[model samples]
Target chain A: MRSVALQKGLAIAVPALVFGFLVAAQWATLAAPGSRDVGIRYIDPLTASLGRLQDEQTSLKAQLADVRAKLDQLQRAGAAQNGTVRDLSAQLDDLKRRAGLTDASGEGVVVTLDATRAAADLTQDRLPCFAPDLTDIVNAAWRGGARAVAIDGERIVASSSVYCVGGTIVVNGSIVSAPFTVTAVGPTSSILAVVDDPSQLSDLKRRRDQQVVDLRIASVPAVTLPAYGGPVVVRSATPQ
Target chain B: MRSRVGGAAVAAVALLLGVLVVSQFRSRDVYSRSLEQETPESLTTLIADLNDRNRQLREEIFDLQLRVDRAQSQVSGGQGTLEESQRQLEQLEVFSAQSRVTGPGISIRVDGPFDDHALSDLVNELRNAGAEAIAVNDARVGPRSWFAAGANGDLVVDGTGVRGPWTVRSIGASDVLYVAMTRTGGIVGQFQLIYQRTRFTVTRENALDLPPLAAQ
Candidate 1:
């Protein structure tokens, strides 16, 4: 009778303990930060919203291009008929070029930044390429007297901003991922001088040394940068 | 007989636990697979970018409509074509940092030891807040303007050395710019966080003038 009772206790206790363990494990997994629950709850809606916005942007860009083409045609026709208009057109073209409204190509330096293998490892806490990192590279090129600058094909303009939305970097309202390529058109030697200097780009250099980021800088004879295709609105300031 | 019945009951309980564990594991696998490509941070960023893009698109639509009107006027030989062109040129001149601009805006006076990175971040924050024109000390901030550390730890804006007690003037809507500068988690707050000794005095002015870029 005693042996039978002991076996009965063992049978019940073993399964009960196993069931409790399983329940606790499942609960812990669900309750932890960055768990499946959080990911599914937030990511799905955000991604869907992003897709809709991108679609809207594409449509708007198409409309803007159409209007711009029309304006160009009208200006060209006017320039052909009137000398004053022709001169004004030339001046406008120069200003537009200066304002980054037109494509530019010249000798300059190209800096490419990529996350290293270490950064790819999930255990690493720091990302080698952030908004500030890209901003620093762009600024360094400008300090070296770049005529025009583009990052990942988005032209830098007065109103353009480089910022991080999350882990991704954004420039002029466009999403850009690494490996980020910063192309600057100017005096090649001067641009390279600043971009390659460790003192000037200390943060990037530190990361490069740590194998966090792979940074490559080279001078090219000619690099073409696309025009500023983003909005050009001055809603606040009036000429004073 | 009692032992046999107990064994069957234990076997049933084990099978039920196995099924529950398997189901939970399967659900977890599906959830992780769905989220493998994106982290929560990345997803949040995507949402913010989308919102910003939509706002920009709205602004672009407004600008394009104006351009269309201008083009139609020019095509019809309207007398305002030259005036329109001149107006557009002036706007571009201000935007390209080729001319002086004055408007209601905000000025921030910062007194502390800060690096070029901080200053650049400040300028970027102003731009993000829709500053039409910006100037640090006397140097105009342009599209190509860059801030760097000068010799002796001085801040250099496009090669112009500027020390502490830096005054940053921006041209934009006074109220909007003011709120942006003073808001929680704004540039001023961020600066204070990083530079503990920094003092930032932000004032909204009815009229502030910003000079053009110095001749290069």
Candidate 2:
């Protein structure tokens, strides 16, 4: 009788357990589709999200580079537009001269004069005329009307000089052997008048009387003034 | 046999359902591999294409950098030229203004009655006489060139080379300059060359041309 009761209990328990398992499995199947674990199928959602972030970073960097390039272009354009701050003619001429592009030679009148010492030109038994004689010659030249003038093939600016001490004549602060020729561009009448001045006459007379150095004057109608070709050193001058 | 066959058919259907259920559960596996299909091929293609584009861009950048550098140097040189030209023009203008004169003027030339010493003394007198702008020989009448005597007997004044005709011509009021030139120690009185007839003549004239002004 105990064996039959045991057999009866197992038969009933076995069928009931099977039915419960079926119902549980059906519920599990319905829930499995909507779970977070579904994200693992086909592609790992986390890895995909990481890949998207990397792509975004790359895109952002490219944008930044583009912006930087645009900014640089704009700055360069602004600098190019800066206006000239000085007079153009002066600027061009100076630049040209520095580059050895000067057009400062032409047909002009040439003046030649010499200095000789004598007794009458002296004062207190001493030589009274000095470098001032040179001054007289240049002034006369200007009065004669010269556009561009030079001494011994060297262009003379406002800063050029003539220093005479003892027996030396310095031109532009440099000693040069001379039968010095001063050239100018203008009509011959004014040039002749300049040559016929009184101071020049006196210097000639003194040279003849005392036989100081040597005195002579010659006026040339056609003389080609050569452009000065030397070191093109330049310094800025204080503006007036 | 027929009953056994029916039982087998049902068992087969149940087995199929069990397999389907297991497959569904496998699809929801949390421990799935991170690897994806065709990963290497896609990455390789992307890398190769990007590298090509990058190389082209780098070449362009290098060329542009060179061009920009050259342009910069050119601009710098141009600016320097502009500045130098301006300087020359200003110097010319100053000269033009100081030398312009219109009217009766006096011309005085004194190189030396006897020697360079006589010329120097006359120079002192000329300065005392209020002479303006002097030069000797081919040299100019600058602070350094003043009193610079010509080795070949030439005297420069105001950049004009004067030899014997040490002409000093004044515009307008040369009388004052002349008066000052002839002071007791001036060339008019003390210069030995004047006494020796070293050629000293002072006269008033409407015009005169000792020489051309030096041009630099």
Candidate 3:
């Protein structure tokens, strides 16, 4: 009987051992280096396309810088030669400054909106509404007397629109993700008065209270806003 | 003793099989989660967005190059500075809402109950679609314009009270503005979903005039 039991055990143990070995081997192969490429193979083409687009953007930006530099040089030269040109140049500069085409710096406020730990859990559903909240903050800043404003380093110009497109916040045609930083150049007191008031930004205030987002406002002695970099030509509108 | 030994062997194999299965499943779970974060569709959208931005940058570069050429010629020619500067100033003034503007654009008339937020969204959509100038009722939207709910649920633009049927006129490419406002899931559609009673009529106009912002 003992011999028979041992024989049965051998039958079970031998196959089980072989099956276990096979599984172990397969697991090791999957865990091995370069095995992850099986999944990445599907993403490779998309990754390559993204890389190409990024490189194109870099080249385009360089060209823009070059052209803007040349325009500046010509403007300076024209201003130096004639009195009327100089006067017009000054007027143009003022208009450009007011139009947010020129960089601005002064005592102002910085408002930052960041997703909290709780926000991470609710991001997909709740975070898309961040655009309107950001709009309210910016509008409050403007009402409180901000001369120039920028969100996440993208200057807010006359044509800048803060809105959501597929769960992303777009400012001036550029996609930005949180934590959103808004820098405004103007009277700190005035900006704070409007921004700090819960009435002006009720939705953001409620979201902050619920710990959905963290809102911070700080007054700085000097804050500089970058000039608008997007297309500025009036292609369709004619001045009357 | 032989049976015990066999049982021990079986138990050890079972443990090994269980571990292998768990590890395999864990790895697969991680891989799938990572793929979810960057699906092919999302990546394609990102690529298309980047392409659009690069196109805009190229256009900006070309425009700037033309300006530089014109400025260089004017500086050398000595007669075009005043005209060029005046032209640039007028453009800037139009952008800043400091001068009146007239152009082919689109007009939206809201003939029902709507809040300032809806108006703000409409204006934002117009700006996103390249509206060079915007005016709601009689109030011109400037660089620092803000829409707020005034007393009694009235719509206020930069502290100016405006009543409905509100007419929003924007200066831009008429076709582009119209498409932006009326497209599926656009502002008009969104408003239709939220404000059921409101009627939004978007008309492409050959000529629309927008006045400068009233002095603060």
How does each model score on lDDT? Answer: 0.76, 0.44, 0.77
- For every prediction, compared with the true complex, DockQ reads 0.26, 0.02, 0.36
* Total backbone collisions for each predicted model: 0, 120, 0
Q: Poorest 10 consecutive residues of model 2 chain A by lDDT?
A: A230-239
Instruction: For candidate 3, write residues B42-152 as lDDT tens digits.
Output: 556766777787788988888777777788888898754666677778888988888988999999999888998778778878998889999998899999898888776
* Cα interface RMSD of each candidate: 9.9, 39.4, 8.6
Question: Which runs in model 3 stand beyond 4 Å of their true positions?
Answer: A1-48, A51-55, A123-129, B1-39, B77-80
- Model 1 bad stretches (over 4 Å): A1-39, A122-129, B1-45, B78-80
Clashing pairs in 1: none
* Native interface contacts kept by each candidate, as a fraction: 0.44, 0.03, 0.50
Candidate 3 predicts chain B with a TM-score of: 0.78
Top candidate when judged by DockQ against the true structure: 3
- Write one digit per residue (lDDT tens) for candidate 1, span B28-118: 3311112223566776766676677768777777776787687667767744346556766787888888888888889999887888898
* Best first by lDDT, ranked: 3, 1, 2
Candidate 2 is graded, for docking, as incorrect
